[model samples]
Target: MNLSSKSVLVTGGAGFIGSSLVRELLREDAEVTVLDNFSAGDPSHLAGLDGSLEVVEGDIRDSSLTSLLERKEVDCVFNLAAEPYIPYCYDRPAQFFEVNANGTLNLLLACKEAGVERILHYSSSEVYGSAKHVPMDEEHPTLPLSTYAVSKLAADRLCFTMYHEQEVPVIILRQFNCYGPRETYPYIIPELISQLSKGPDLQLGNIKARRDFTYVEDAVRGAIELMKCDRAVGEVVNLGSGIDYSVEELSHIIGELMGYDRVNIEIAKERLRPLDVERLQCDYSKARELCGYRPKTSIAEGIERTIDWFRENNERWIWEVKIAPSERIWRKDDGC
Candidate 1:
């Protein structure tokens, strides 16, 4: 689907990656309607969008999605809405399953009813779990270790099933560790940035595990590229950097990017996942072959850019972290 002058519906457009994709779609002058419940997303993310962008406050689990799609007459629907935080999923598996699994079923059914073509579903590398081999590809055995991972795996397979069984025009684009500005949950990058934002010491867990990180902008670009590739319909592709870096190594690089002096690193047992995936590296050869997907932002450059954003918006993250730190159980903080 050519995005230029087309109408697109981006669910969860107020999120970090969703907002980035909204900007990308707006650059092409596509009419966009963003559907979000603002649970973790903020209206501020979509503040500067021109008349081409429409913001709707709603839940992906709601049947109103069908009405919205019918009204907008969108050519494509991008499902980026889900309950994705790992810890949160552990605490409330029912909630995560409802939003990540059943909520997806709701949206896919709506898309089918509305005759919306080319639905791009957001997937994650967590579905691949610990890599049995280096640079895990789409064929990697899915041994999901966490509730969040299991929920996403269910949703990812649901997309494939919809495509094959119901003939729903759908594609699953799974991305590696995604990080950038407006990132609510403190992953390694934001945890370091937020800690530095307030003070000096960085508290983390399981720094030995390795991950393939991808910047938000490049992930959005890969998603859009996949959306346009006609051959990608009913297929799954991995958008990864094809490189893995340890959390400890990433922390030092982040410190370097932030230009920290005598950085204090502390390991917090509470911050670690109950069962951690040892390593994940992306084999995006299929992405390159199918959709010409190449993540442009390197970890160094992306960290620099993300640090710049944190520096500008220090108060927002700092205040939020102070209210509900990552060590404590996840809370529904509406401040941001």
Candidate 2:
């Protein structure tokens, strides 16, 4: 279906990738309604967008969602709301399931009630845990390692089951590690950038663990394209760069870009997760075949863009960055 002039609802639209998706949908002339609780999302991310945008500070688990969907006459829904912080999940595993799994069920029920045409459920690559093989595909065995991954996997299965049982036109888009501007959390890319911005010395964990990082814009574009393709409904697709980079390599690249000839690397146990996925690499061939999707941004180019954003908006993401050691690790009580 064409997105032009369509009414779209983006859950968690105030977030990093969600905000970027909201911007792109507006560019397509789609009337956008953002439903976010601002738990991990920032209100300022939606600031200064030129479009028919409606912002709702609400949660996906709200009982009023059906009424809201009907009132707005939303044509499509992009579900991105979730408790995504990994370390925090260890502290509150139940919250992750509540938001990622049960909350998704609530949205699905609302869509069923409101007769919403389509729903693109944003899932995470963590559901696959560490790769059992190179270039993980949609059919990869889902052996999630952490609570966050298991919660996401539960949501994914919910979407798939809902599509078959309730006939809710749902597409599960499993997005790999996404990094770009407006990211609130202290993930690897943002964390490294934050540290490097301050000095050359870096403290990190599991530098050998590899991940396939996809630029936010590219990931959003892939989702939009899949939504536009009818064949993608009731299917799971992977969105990624089709390449992987180790954390150590990523740090060095960031250091080099920041004009640091050599940066001090300190591997601290406090930064390591007990149940960290060792490696992640995406196989997006299904996306290519179904929707003619291919990631357009390279890692270096994306990192440069991210660095530029952080440089211009230091106050936006600068905060007391926290990692492992359990004590310093982010908890659910820690206000996002």
lDDT, residue 142, candidate 2: 98
lDDT of 1 by residue, 155-244 (tens): 998998999999999999888888887776566777777666555677889989999989988888888989999999998889988889
**Following a full C-alpha superposition, what root-mean-square deviation does model 1 have from the true structure?**
3.3
Q: Candidate 2's residue-wise lDDT over 1-336, tens digit each? A: 999999999999988899999999999999999999876777788999998999999999999999999999999999999987898788788888999999999999999999999999999999999999989999899999999999999999999998998799999999999999877547889888878877899999899999999999999999999999999999999999989999999999999999999888999999899888999999999999999999999999999998888776644443233553222222221111
lDDT of 2: 0.89
Q: Show the colliding residue pairs in model 2.
A: none
Candidate 2 similarity to native, TM-score: 0.94
Residue 56 C-alpha lDDT in model 1: 91
Residue 11 in model 1: lDDT:
91
Candidate 1's C-alpha runs over 4 A off are 318-336
User: Poorest 10 consecutive residues of model 1 by lDDT?
Assistant: 318-327
* Number of clashes recorded per candidate: 0, 0
The C-alpha lDDT values of all candidates are: 0.83, 0.89
